[model samples]
Target: MRSTAHTDPVLTQSGCSSTAVRALQISIAADKALVAEVRHTVRTALESWGASVIADDMAVVASELASNALKHAGSEASVRLRLSEGQALLEVDDSSMQRPVARRVGAEVEEGRGLFLVQALAAEWGWRYREDGGKTVWASLPVPAGSAA
Candidate 1:
């Protein structure tokens, strides 16, 4: 098992106190069948962040974002979970230049509601294209005030 400590130079030299737990980064191929596993991984990361109390919302947003990446974006992707400034951030990176823009849909449609769902559940969400390639869709949800697990 990996020790829960910041062993990287970036974390050690950044002046980031151990008081603020280092964030978790999970990189994996964007597989549709692994969505549940991705959600579970985010929940575990949140718990490791000492934010297990509000993990429910974080997990939902994570699931939605992962699903969006798998469905609309490419299979090569990554998920990152972090705790900072009294909030939790979930980021999904996929190898596609296309940013996720909301699309209108008819009631009869069976799917295509990923971004809408993310918008509803997350405190805030958006996307940014990387300078080299690809893009990331990210969301932030405030940890419940006064409840830091």
Candidate 2:
């Protein structure tokens, strides 16, 4: 897996204007390899942003989202990580319109638990269709206190 990232100023949503901060985005390949790559990228990004406390949670959520995209969509995905106003946002874009379903699996089951884990880990999670024949699944996790975006 190969990725590229950059930091750019992002405007705040508050009515009062405020300073912008950097966000991270990476291009993800559509393969089983994406799972590890997503986890690693999330960890690295959060650590670099001074939010290592939430790195483990964010990485798990990212892996679940990216793995689902590659397994079901069969197309490359893009991941974006941003910290804004005390929240960490993660988005995974893939070329599939099929919304993810979270199923209740038995303890013995080895599959059908991805979305469930995502819902359990993320503060919020959802999906939206793109105009260009694809969709993006997004999750949000709160940034730890004293952490910088």
Q: Model 1 lDDT vs. the true structure?
A: 0.75
Over 65-115, each residue of candidate 1 has an lDDT whose tens digit, in order, gives 888887777576788777765788888888788778877789999877778
The lDDT of each candidate is 0.75, 0.83
Best by lDDT: 2
Instruction: Note the residue pairs that clash in candidate 2.
Output: none
Question: Estimated TM-score per prediction?
Answer: 0.81, 0.88
Q: Which parts of model 2 have CA positions greater than 4 angstroms off?
A: 10-20
Q: Write one digit per residue (lDDT tens) for candidate 2, span 5-98.
A: 5665555677567643547777877678668977998898888877888889999999888888988899888888887667889998999988
RMSD of 1: 4.0
